[model samples]
Structures are given as structure tokens and as C-alpha cells.
Target: MRAVVYDAPGAFSVREVPVPEPGPGEVRLAVEMAGMCGTDVHIDAGGFFSRYPLTPGHEIVGRVDALGDGVTSLARGEPVVADNTVLCGHCAPCRRGEPLFCANFYSLGVNGPGGFADCVVVRAEKCFAAGDLDLGTAVMAEPTACVVHGLDVLDLRPGADVLVFGAGPTGLVLAQLLAHGGAARVTVAAPTARKLDLARSYGTDVTVEIDRSDPARALPVLRAAAPDGYDVVVDATGAASVVEICLGLVRDGGTFFVYGMADEQLSVPLHPYEVFRRELTIKGSFAQTHCFERSLALLRSGRVRTDGLVTHEFALGDYGLALEATRSDRSCVKAAVVP
Candidate 1:
């Protein structure tokens, strides 16, 4: 087997390694494709709870190569998506029906060996049948699951006017989810015209191309679109400055959802008086929990499209290049590694 191994932070290499075997209740998957995103970039920099000497790919789709003892629900050669998150059922959060906040959280690729290899083993229950979805689309299951969880947290109301910031893969997906999930009109704001153009096809009713460094310059344009402000404002850009701007766009008594992953040390000023006077609601959503199946179902049903979302693909040996592309390549929306 071949794998991209991270021996330490800011260090990695692709090398041949012995194939791993599955234990009881687990199955070994022959890696087909693994999706790379900003999270991978963070992991490469040694943040995001990443464990060293790890194979860093969390969004994965592969074929069942071998099954371990007691695993009869799946068979060899079946295509499936991996749910890299492993939760301890006995944890306080798990017992409270909040597995996302599990006290003992272990996510592959983040804190363990993952799918950035020719082969990897995961619990059989974590494997979701990809059905007939192509590798490109199936590999999106993890991200879509995160979007699903975000929507779940938002609990959006039907016919509400929505505004989303950022047009990245997750941002576009979240926009589509908001568009179809119940928002009467969904608007996307981003600095890139190309991504804004793509968002139009994914159920975005309006697209605003704002200058990232001077977002306020476009406020007049945005206000012209929604003079009363949006019923729900979301920041999917993960930039604290962007989030700060987005918070001011929420209508009175409306909700503001934070769906982007920002720097841990970053802080944004918030006026508690404004929130109190307006009776506003603020929410945040992290990585998913119990949403993988729904994401796959949405992809399979064509309700949530993945077209043009995966703009780049790389080979296993070019894992470093893939990470770099994901980190700095504005041309690359989503990068996939075909191991």
C-alpha cells in the first residue's frame, strides 16, 4: 500500500507502506478518491487537533476490499463513503443526544490514520453505501453532511429571506441547502465572480461580488437588494472581519448563523446591547454528527448538486501539491486525490 504520511506538523511525504487489516466490526477500503479542503490545510499546519504520523484525508470514498470478523452488512467491492468521526458512546455529550460534542472525539485524518492512502480500515457502521454516485460526487458526502448539520442547527424557517457569505465548496453547498431547505430567496455574497456565477446555478437567487478587503463598499448594493435586511444572515467565509460585517445584516429578531471555520485565536467584536435590544439569535455549527446518510441521500436524489464544485484532482503521489492547491489556489474549488 502507498500512503501520504505526516510525521510532524508542516511535514509530509508519500511512501509505500504495508497494507492494513481490519479488526472485528471493521472493513478495509481500497481508497478510490479523497477530497481535500481548508481543513486539510489546517491539519498540515499542525492545528485542528491533528495527530502526528497520520494519513490526513477525512472526506473519502472507496470500495470495500475486505471485511473483518462479524461484519456481514457489507461485501467486497461495494463502493462506500467513510464517516471518519468516531465517538465514544459513553461520553456525556453522546448520552445527551449531542454526539457532535462528544468528550472523547476521534476523527480520522484529523487525529488518526485516514484515507490518504491506497487502503484504510474503518468501522463497518461508518461505511455508507455510495450507491451509483461517481467518485467525484460520492467524495462530497462528508462536506454535505457538515452542511446538513449546519442546516439542522440553523433550523431555518420557511419563506425566510437568507443571505450567505462566501462561495467556496461548503459555502455553495450551504447556499443550495438553504435555497432548497426552505429559504424563500437565497443570496450569496463573495469576492470571486466565477464562484458567484457558479452559485447562481446551485439555487442562489442573487449573487453579490464584494471586495473582500472593502466589504463595506458593497453594503449599499446589498442594502438595495434587501432594504429591511435578511431574515437570516450567515457567514461561511470563516473570516472574522466578514463575520463581523454579516452580523450587522441580520434583521431585527432574526438569526445569524456562523458556519465557517475561522482561526482559533481570532476574535470579532460584538455589541451585546444590539443583540439584547433586537432580541436576535446567534448560532454556530461545527462538523457533522449523524448527518452522513442524509447528505448521501440528498446527493443521490439530485436535490443537492455537486457539479463544477470539484474543480481540481490530483494523484496520491501529489498529495503535497493537492494540499497546496487547496490552501492557496483560488482556481481550485475542491481538490480530490485519486489514490
Candidate 2:
């Protein structure tokens, strides 16, 4: 099997490795497609804590080539998408029905061998059938599940106004989810004109060009575009300062959802008094949960547009090229690696 291995920070290479077999309560997948995400780049850059010589891909879709002991719900040859979350079912958070907060939680791409190869072995419970969707579309289920989690926390009412920061894959998906959730208007802010155009295609009613160098200057422009102030503000940029700016842009009683991962420490002015006075709700959503099934349903319904989101694709051996393109190409919306 050919896999991309992360040797160290800023280093990755395609190498031949033995194909894995399913273990107890696990399933072995003939990996069909995997999406290149920001997290993959972070892992490759050692921005996150990860073991070296790792295979870092979690946005995966494949067929059930084999099943481990006790696996019965899924059949061999079934198309599936794997859930990254690996939770300790008896942990405090898990007992509370918050598996995402499990004390002993780990993820596929981060904690174990991931799906960027010819074969991937995952826990049986984490693999969900993709029905009749193609491999590429099925690979997107993971990210869309994250969007579902974001929407779950957002709790936006019909006609609520939304402002999405960053027009990347996650942000675009979030915009479409907000639109489908009955948001009256969704405005996407990004530095690149191409991404903004992509966001518009995903039903973003307004688009603003943000100055990456002078992010603060975009606040006034965003305020003008959302005159009444946004009812729901989502920061998917993963930049701490950008998240802070999003918090400031929301209306007095609006909700602010931080869906991005800020790997570094961020210092920002706090307004505890304003939070109390306005009764605002600020929340963070990490990873997907039961939302994976919801994401599949959304894809099946064809309510959200994913066609334009897949702007680039590469062969499994071209993982380096794919990651580089995702990081540097302003026009690339979402890149997939097909094995």
C-alpha cells in the first residue's frame, strides 16, 4: 500500500507500507478518496501534537474490504465514511452524552494511522454507510458533519442574519448550512476574491474582501454590510484575532460560534461586562458527533451545493503537491486525494 508519511515538521513523503487488517470491533477500508484539510497541513507542520511518521488524513471515504470480530452492522463492499472521534464510552463526558468531550477522546488522523492510503483500519462504530454517493462526495461527509455540529450550537432562528469569517471549505459549508437552516442572509468575508465568489455560489448573500494584513479595517466594512449587526457570527478562520473580531461584530444578544482551531495563544481585549449586559452566548464546536449521519442526509437531499467546493483533486502519491496547493492556492476551495 502507498501512504503519505509525516516524517517531521514541514516534511512528508509517499512511501510503500503493508496494508492493515481489521482488528476486533474494527473495519478495514479500501480507501477511495480523502480530503486534504487545514488540519492535515497543521499535522504536517507539527502545529499539533502528533507522533512522527504518521499518516494524517481523516476526511475519508472507502469501501468495506473486510470486517473485524463482532462487526455485523456493515457489510463487505459497502461504501462508508469514517468518524474520526474515538471516545471512552464510560468517561464523564461520554456518560453525559457529550462524546466529543470524552476525557480519553482521540481522533483517527491525529491519534492513529489515518486514511490517506490504499487501506485504512478504523473502529467499526466510526464507519457509516454512504448509501449510493460516489467516493469523492462521501469523503466530504466528515467536514459536513463538523458543519452540522456548528449549526447545532448556533441554534439560529429562521431569518437570522449570519456573518461567516473565512471562505475556506469549512466556512463555505457553514454558509450553506446557515442558508438551509433558514438564515435570511449569510455574508462571507475572505481575503481572496475567488473564495468569495465560491461562497456566493454556496448561497452567501453578501461577500466582503478582508485585508489579511489589516484585518481590523474590515470590521467597519462588515458592519456596514450587516447594518443591523449579525444575529449569528461564525469565525472559521482559526486565527485568534479574527475570532475576536467576529465576537465584536455580533449583535448585542447574538450568538458567536468559534468553529476554527487556534493552535497558538491569542491575546484579545475582553468585555465581560458586555457579555453580561447583552446576555450573549459565545460557544465553541469541535469535531463532529451524531452529525455525521445528518451530513449524509443533507448530501442525499441535495439541498446544499458541494459540486463547486471540490476545486482540486490529486492522486494519493501527490499528497505533498495537494497539501502545498491547498496552502498556497487562493483559488482552490477543497482538494481531494484519490487512491
> lDDT scores for all predictions?
0.91, 0.84
lDDT of 1 by residue, 1-339 (tens): 899999998888999989999999999999999999888887888888887888999998999999999999999999999999999999889999888889989998899889999999999999999959988789889999999999999999999999998999999999999988889999999988989889997769999999988787888888888898899999997887788888678889999998888877789899999999998999999999789989998999989999998888899999988888888787888899998
TM-scores of the candidates in the order shown: 0.97, 0.94
Poorly placed runs, candidate 1 (over 4 Å): none
Off by over 4 Å in 2: none
What lDDT does model 2 reach?
Answer: 0.84
Measured by TM-score, how close is model 2 to the native structure? 0.94
lDDT, candidate 2, 8-104, per-residue tens? 7778788999889888999999888889888887787687657777888889898899999999988999888999778888999899998888888
**lDDT accuracy of residue 157 in candidate 2:** 95
Best lDDT goes to which candidate? 1
